[model samples]
Target: MKYGSTSAPIQLARGQAMSSVKPWRPDEPAATIHAEGAWLQGAFISKIFYGIIIVLSWQCLSLLWRQTTRSNYKTKMSFLAIVFAIFSFSTLHSGYDMKAIQLGFVENRNFPGGPSAYATLSRSDTPGNIACILMQWLCDALLIWRFVMIYRGCVAPMWLLAATPITVYLGSIVIGILFTIKKLTSGSGVRRT
Candidate 1:
């Protein structure tokens, strides 16, 4: 054989290399879990994770305002009180504990199957699921109190008075319930598809 000539072995090796380095094929089918139509599993937690910091910052500012303004102490304190209460609840509900639950580091005993069984199959866990559920319930109660106060304080538009707090409380309740149910039924194990 002529040493410099193109030969079958070189051609076969080149063919093998090309096949081994084949590009990804878009036509390949993909599989994913429906996850019971839950939206909060991924997107929701990420949003809330970032939002906790902002809520805590607001709480800090409200506290500082109350401390610095002596002449308007009553007004500042009142505003700060409301802000602090809300922020405290928000922080507790949105804090890292919730994230840990979501991430599945802390097992959710509330799940239907035994913790080990569920854990064996789950992919992700939201850490603060418990805190969020409790917080939403608390928010509902607070909204009722606020609604009553607003009604007694002034003759505001009926629509505005009815809509704002009701929407917030109800929305939170719905979200919390949905997340709780999802967590309970989804099993205890973590698996990635």
Candidate 2:
């Protein structure tokens, strides 16, 4: 099946069944239909994994909170902020995904090119995508901070050593911003502009 602006063949697995999926009209391209089906399936799997991560994260956050003390207030608070930011971003991402899923499957199931296509056209998932990107940037920044801390005294020229990662991180931010802009501007992936 073809999806978006791309036309490529896709086939169901040998034993796979389409009983759960309603048939698309004959006028719609098979590729677009199949792509939507695939996205729906992937969304289901993503939710399952997201649930597991949320559980583990909450447990870790609780443990951290319990272990925090007055002496380590600064460090602990910083960590807490980072963790909370991550949690918030991820929650936003997941919530948006669920919202889109509901709209696609329940509210707009009959939308042209299917729910997946509708998602692309409407750009309804942009917030989720932004959250995901922000979460990634936060994680990367944390890693870089940890790296600098670890190599602080040992490195003869700390600034030089840190320069590469900082540059790369900045580059990534610019790229991400450009990508978001592109996504926001593009009309729809289902139809070529």
Q: How many steric overlaps are in each model, in order?
A: 24, 4
* Candidate 2 lDDT tens digits, 99-186: 8788876887777767766777766778898998998899889999998999998847988989999999999899989989988999
| Model 1 residue 86 distance off true place after TM-score fit, in angstroms | 5.0
The C-alpha local distance difference test score for the whole of candidate 2 amounts to 0.80
Q: What overall lDDT goes with each candidate model?
A: 0.57, 0.80
- Report how far residue 124 has shifted in candidate 1, in Å: 6.4
- Among the numbered candidates, top TM-score falls to 2
Tens-digit lDDT track for model 1 on 1-193? 6877778767777777768564433222232123312333654675665487566757666577847666887866765665565556556655554444444423454444333334445634444456556655765776777677768656677667777777877888788788777776765445432
Off by more than 4 A, model 2: 1-30, 188-193
Q: Least accurate stretch of 10 residues (summed lDDT) in model 2?
A: 6-15
